[model samples]
Target: MTVIDNTHQRLLPAPAADVGRLLDRIGRPGDPLWPSPTWQPMRLDRPLSVGATGGHGPVRYHVSDYRPGRLVEFTFDPRIGLTGTHTFEVIDHGDDACVLRHRLVATPSAHMRPLWPALIGPCHDTVLEHLLDNAEHAVTGTVTDPVRYPWQARLDVRLFSVQVNATSVPQNALLLEAALPPAAGPRSDLADAYAARVPPGVTTDPQAWADAIFGNPPPAVTALFRLRNALVTPFGIERGDRSAFDTISRTDRELLLGTDAGHLDFRASILVEPDDDGVTVTLSTHAVAHHRTGRLYLALVRLFHPPVVRAMLRRAAAAAVRPRPVTPPGLPTTTPLR
Candidate 1:
């Protein structure tokens, strides 16, 4: 087995003690500044101490060493491919600043070699950068450059499949299935309302409402829709741009949004069909993986697709039932659908 090491660091404009205090709270689930959007927050079975078991999402690990306001190390489970330690340490940089570092030193087994550079490495870099940005925000009250996924990293992990029950407010299907011309697309009022409530730096363009049915959307209106879809399907894909929604397909009952991300092609639809009581809205996605890495990367995604899709669908259903104001006629809007 060959050893592979990855390290990422950020300088905070604060003292070591202040930085360490923030580091101590890094893995706590639901922390406002913890970067849960980039990397799912870690849920630990016990408090931050040696021997506590916890990991974020699918990765499981146990704490091997711990020190308050200084360092913590998690030794990942062997089943996760590489066997090694992931450590977070805080060091004094000067009277005014401190450096926070995350280091992963692991030896991968033969079978895991292809996965490193292709999938894991890119995702790791993305999540780490966001985490650092989160730390800076904690100390400085602002993030200089909010984290955005690199194009390659976004392409490598994009996968979308979700279904949501819009039975409570069946009219949601109408809103969900609304179409825009391939060029100047019409905005979805419901989506715009939702997007306005999202935090800064996220997009709320109405076109995103369709593209989000199957892609990983940023922390914008698409994300809100994805959460709604999660009520039925728990999974989604993320990318940085609206280029994914460039092409449009529409029928009386369905609306499709399509785009190509490098070597991968993505097509997603919102289908509205009548049911026993109200309408049933189904959001589905299909992808054409173009190369060897694409196939292999998607294979990994398939393992978690079912749960991810279901979660997204369930959430979307719940959201549809919430009351919202309808956009009035003749009101000025963003754009018009041809």
Candidate 2:
């Protein structure tokens, strides 16, 4: 038998079950190590597909052991360059929190382990940050930025944790789409393509842009649009800016680079509304689902969800309309010296 091991720990302000769900998100569904979208209702014993999205190379996963509120272990193809089994565990602290741990028994091929220090090292840190932030958000109402953590570790196993804010869902389609990666295209080409779909004048003003994207959304929607675009076009106010942008609300709209880790579908919507507050705009931030034209047509529901887009529009409108502090009158006009 092969032996490999490593570990990290995080103290979260959440119960074991909630912590377990947060851990599940660490390795995306259909990740090379865990191939499939569906998590088993009971312990996973046989091989299974962890997710259904396309773009994943062929791989197999087997869930070997599970203990409610405690531990889960699984094995899968590590790809040719990587090989391993993964374990996710939770240790109760006898309070409102628990310690979450992840361990991987991996052996990299000749080229991978050496290069991993530089390549995977940084991303592993990012993964940990993401886990903690996601956990805090899951447990609390505030959204914490994932860039705060600075600890780094190298191990045959990976571990991450965070205090999650409790979130509820009513089976809306938008959340699923938000979980996907973004589409890809040349910056100019993508902007041009999206611009073509954007009606004139609307892209000029942040408020108008919101109106154009959402069907007369609220002022908050306008603010959200402006914020999201601001992130994309930090310097230039061009509608064709190509920078990748992300929206992280319960419902979100994002323009992602294709080179990102996961596969994505492309979808969008534009709407306009008129009111005293200004035109409210709503935009769809959905990617086409990896599945369509299959025997399971119900799967299409999973493909094109847009609720998050709506929610983002609402928030943007609120942020857009928030009162800005007025600039005090400038000092008396200065006379020009001859």
CA lDDT, every prediction? 0.56, 0.38
Candidate with top TM-score is 1
lDDT of 1 by residue, 161-182 (tens): 1123222323444533343334
lDDT of 2 at 214: 43
lDDT of 1 at 310: 52
Off by over 4 Å in 2: 1-4, 21-62, 140-338
Model 1, position 218: C-alpha lDDT score? 31
lDDT of 1 at 101: 88
Error of 2 at 49 (Å): 9.3
